[model samples]
Target chain A: MASAPAQADLRTRLQNFIPKLVLAPSVAVIFLFVYGFIIFTLYLSFTDSRILPSYNLVGFENYSKLFRLSHWTTSITNLAIFASLYIGISTLIGLALATFLDQKIRGEGLLRPIYLYPMALSFIVTGTAWKWLLDPGIGLEHTMHLWGWESFQFGWIKNSDYAIYTVVLAAVWQSSGFVMAMFLAGLRGIDNEILKAAQMDGASNFQMYRRIILPQLRPAFLSAFVILSHLAVKSYDLVIALTGGGPGRATELPATFMYSYTFTRNQMGIGASSAVIMLMTIAAIMVPYLYAELREKK
Target chain B: MTLIKQLKLSAAVLALTATTAAAADVEVLHWWTSGGEAAALNVLKGDLESQNIGWMDMPVAGGGGEAAMTVLRARVTSGNAPTAVQMLGFDIQDWAKEGALANLNDVASEGGWDAVVPAALQRFSKYEDQWVAAPVNVHSVNWVWANKKLFDDNNISVPTTWEEFEAAMQTLQDAGVTPIAQGGQPWQEATLFDSVVMATGGPEFYQKALIDLDPEALGSDTMKQAFDRLGVIRENVDDNFSGRDWNLATAMVINGEAGMQIMGDWAKGEFVAAGQVPDEDFLCFRFPGTQDQVMFNADQFAMFDQGGTVSEEQAALASAIMSPSFQAAFNVVKGSVPARTDVPDTDFDACGKKGMADLAQAAEADMLFGSLAQGHGAPASIKNAYYDVVTAFFNGSFDSETATEELVTAIEIAQ
Candidate 1:
């Protein structure tokens, strides 16, 4: 302190402020673009806006209409179907693959990249490829028929009753690899000494995995569930590119329903309301998980 | 030597004039991105360029103009609307009511659009007694394209009545032929249903049920009968019809994999692109029960009131769209009859000529109604509700009576 000059001390003060200075602009951007728009959408949802947003407030008239639409109900039902199957199946498959890969198999490095490659492609690409493969007229069913298996049928993408499952399929295919990578990292983190100890205790492979390693992947499971449920709720591109929410609104998700109402059908208020509902749904899933995680960390 | 010098001088003079052309640059927003549609649009673009007016193409394709309309709405909301936007039916009227559309009375009056354009089309072209849009072409949705060989092989006449159409469909089915090649999209099903509605009842019923939104007419036995026929028509389609694109369905008919497709005149554009001749390679007929009537929806360009350097370009574009030569050239390639009655049929092929004739007959009989699939018969909200119920019914969630009731209920809620 005695050796420092006054100008040098001022320079030190300025240097100390740089990190906050650098972070301020992004903070402002996120505030305005994300939270501000959310508030704006919330305001718009209560108004009698159409094609374009108008400021004439109508006090939940839009919400009443939204609930009355059968299509909106259909979208909700489809989301429930998609989210449960998508999350459950993806978790099971990802965990199984992770466990299989954890067995010290040969060519592990090669197989790891192969399993994770689908995660690198965008949901749009995944959707389109799956659509082509599932379309009965040009895809596997047609090829099978040409090869003298004329009775083979795998046209689930075209059936209204089963169309959402195709969306679930595409979504799981896109995300399961990512989930597997998460579980793999978790599995690698477990102490090798504990496995040897469990082996010394006469624990079989399945018993060790069931009693110890699987229980240790708790955090991974929670993270996977949180990420997957949010993705399932916010899924728009996969539905749009795959079946376009159709075969007659069969595969429509909340995101697609929101876009159609807002942009296509000229019901801005209804669209905004649906978007807010979706946001609330995601919040409902995320808030509790995040709270528990943060409390545990503390 | 003098003639050569004169030619060079004229070429230099032309260059000078081109460089001296006006500073008005027009940005056009549309969804016409398909190959044939792009080529057809080039006629208007070329006409503009020849006049030294520049065209800025802003095209967004998909969802049957829904995406383009979305872009336009966002632009208008942000106060940066384009000079012109391609719109259909009630959309033009909707924009005009918003006071965002430019008044085109000057160009329309000078071009004598009143006498040339039909009265029904003029209903959408004008708003509050002022011309707001220029009609490009009339697209009638009640068309059925069939493989000519299949009809001949089955020894079937082009069906004119619903009963005969059912009989022909049954014959084709018995012969192991797919009776209809339909895409499993809501709008396509709604398009087919619109034709069905007109067939089951007359044009008057169509107006009351669709245009006027009369509850009684919508819930009446006539509407239920239309739904019943739709149920049967659903059975005649191929199992793989779900989620198919309209063009692929058209391809099925062209390749003789399917017998017929009930689609719009745009399907002819596909056949033409495939090198199939109309009435020789394929039979283009009015869908059964829709004879002597035409369900018309016009594609029009609405000029937005950009209010600065863009207004001149907007007027220029409007006048050029209404010009007789452009109408003839554009409609010949667009697979629809010209909006202008004065454009001759000499250049149109067999399908186009038949379209023109039917359009004229429809105009005379007062049978032209806007297409629901093209955003005309109702606003987007109400029309989408109808689509929901109709498509759900077509896919077997509802019986005919229940579908009719649901349609009426949807109208009430949306209205």
Candidate 2:
């Protein structure tokens, strides 16, 4: 017993030390690159940095200037529309597909992959394919006309008024499948007894889902909302590939705005400010979720 | 043990050889990844190779040169700047201001770049009387490319003024051919506006408003007129022009699907690629009323400081870029006129020859202004601000008055 205690003390300390040692490099990397660059960007937002980073602090000038620009305003407005629609539509489509699959439908395996296949493709590919499909000239309209459908029209991609919705379309198409997978897992994890009891109580199918199934899938819905919302906010590639933030900056998200200002527009200070704002937005969504997630685990 | 020793010795030898070989090679960061562009870059690469200098090709493709600039900034900031970078417009100036670019005065003076290169290009090539970049080719942005067959079929002559241009577009529209083949991207919209501004208010107004970011000029009636003309042009563009690449618009003109395209001379590359002959299959004209002025964007190779030492490779690269032979060889393949005035237009097509002549005429008159859309007229911030306004007006997001006001405000805020 004396030997066992002595040996266990060294082994326990070694075990603890080894894991931290193994994790040290990645932790330091995350701290230095992710958090460090974030802090650096925060500092740069207050400065007069342009084209390149300069440390001549100008207080709230960049922030003030950023707010005054209509482009920034447009980007913010687009993000609001894109985020709301992308999250709402994707969650709905995902839940619907998951619910349909959960009914033990025929060819569920084939249909499931087909649904998830779009998610497998990168946003760049989805954006590009959808861009071609949505274009009125060489895309769907043209194809339909060639096939003798003279009155076919799907030119939302070209309409500034509706271009953000097209971005919403492409983003939702890509993310919905993944959302479906999440919901499907949640649906599978539901207790069969709960559903049987609902059936025994003579509840309608819709009522059963509404009363029992839907409430249990809160975690999945939360995850999907969080994931889809962040993806919507940080969307750059899809918009870039599909809209390039145009038909007159109609699809200009905050991410694209930050990139354009920082690298292309040479307004690093404003770009940094926009980036800090985006970080704060993500943090606003992420922090409470993380806190709740960890608190529940504890 | 002996085999290990032998292997270690060979490894040492390989390392020594690699460093020595790399010393003579110039690392070039560029976005010339397209087929024709890469071929044109090969001309310079071969020229550099002929001079016994190696080339480290760093091609970052996307956003025109936006992605390349991002990579360049990261490289420069990390203090591992490439030996040279293909840059455009005020980008060279921005880099030079940061003191990351090396002084190319010695090679420039040796190559007689000051006398041979146009002053408009030299404006970007030099910083504080020091040559920091070497211009490769001049890409003029004010040209209107039209399908000659469509023009002939519609019985329309090449328009020389804004009203006549409108009449021609109307004829094309009535004839059921798409009038203007225009991409709907901000830069493309801004490119059309570049010529429209030059056409509407002439070069001096463009100089005052765009380059100088002058509030009075931006807010003036002339600016509104420019927007009004742009609005008319916008009306004529096909409905599906949004998010279309410049080349696709060019193809619309080439295939006779669209009557005309108001685009840069670079669109000619698409025409050439599509096997359409200029002056026969298509006609390249100055955007109406911009015949006297040239809105240009030049591609230049900017050498980095590299710890304040101008290596032989950097100097050779600069000198090679300025040489008349390389300029001619590169531009002919790249579908642009040579940057050098002295380069003969014998090898150029009809449009290329006209571009060279127009460039010379405009340069002589001090009318060679940088294209605002392509980041030559102003710094990126101001140019982008201008783009926001121009694009907004074109897309019906703003009226002429609102666009003008927004233009002035945006430029001021960018400043």
Which DockQ values do the candidates obtain, in the order shown?
Answer: 0.59, 0.70
Screening candidate 1 with a backbone cut-off below 3 angstroms (N, C-alpha, C), the clashing residue pairs are none
lDDT of prediction 1: 0.88
All candidates: TM-score of chain A: 0.94, 0.94
What digit string (tens of lDDT, one per residue) describes model 1 on residues A22-99? 999999999999999999999999998887789999998878887887778889999999999999999999999999
| lDDT tens digits, residue span B305-335, model 2 | 9777788888888888888888898898788
Assess candidate 2 and give its lDDT.
0.87
Lowest-scoring 10 consecutive residues by lDDT in candidate 1 chain A? Answer: A1-10
Q: Worst 10-residue stretch by lDDT in candidate 2 chain A?
A: A289-298
Candidate 2's C-alpha runs over 4 A off are: A1-16, A286-298, B1-18, B33-39, B52-56, B62-64, B272-278, B345-349
- Relative to the unseen true structure, what is the C-alpha lDDT of residue A81 in candidate 1, on a scale of 0 to 100? 94
lDDT, candidate 2, A1-298, per-residue tens: 7999989999999999999999999999999999999999999999998877899999999999989988889999998898888899999999999999999988998999999999888888998899888878788899999999999888788777988898988888888889999999999999999899989999999898899999999889888978887788888999988887888887899999999898877889999999999989888878998788758756
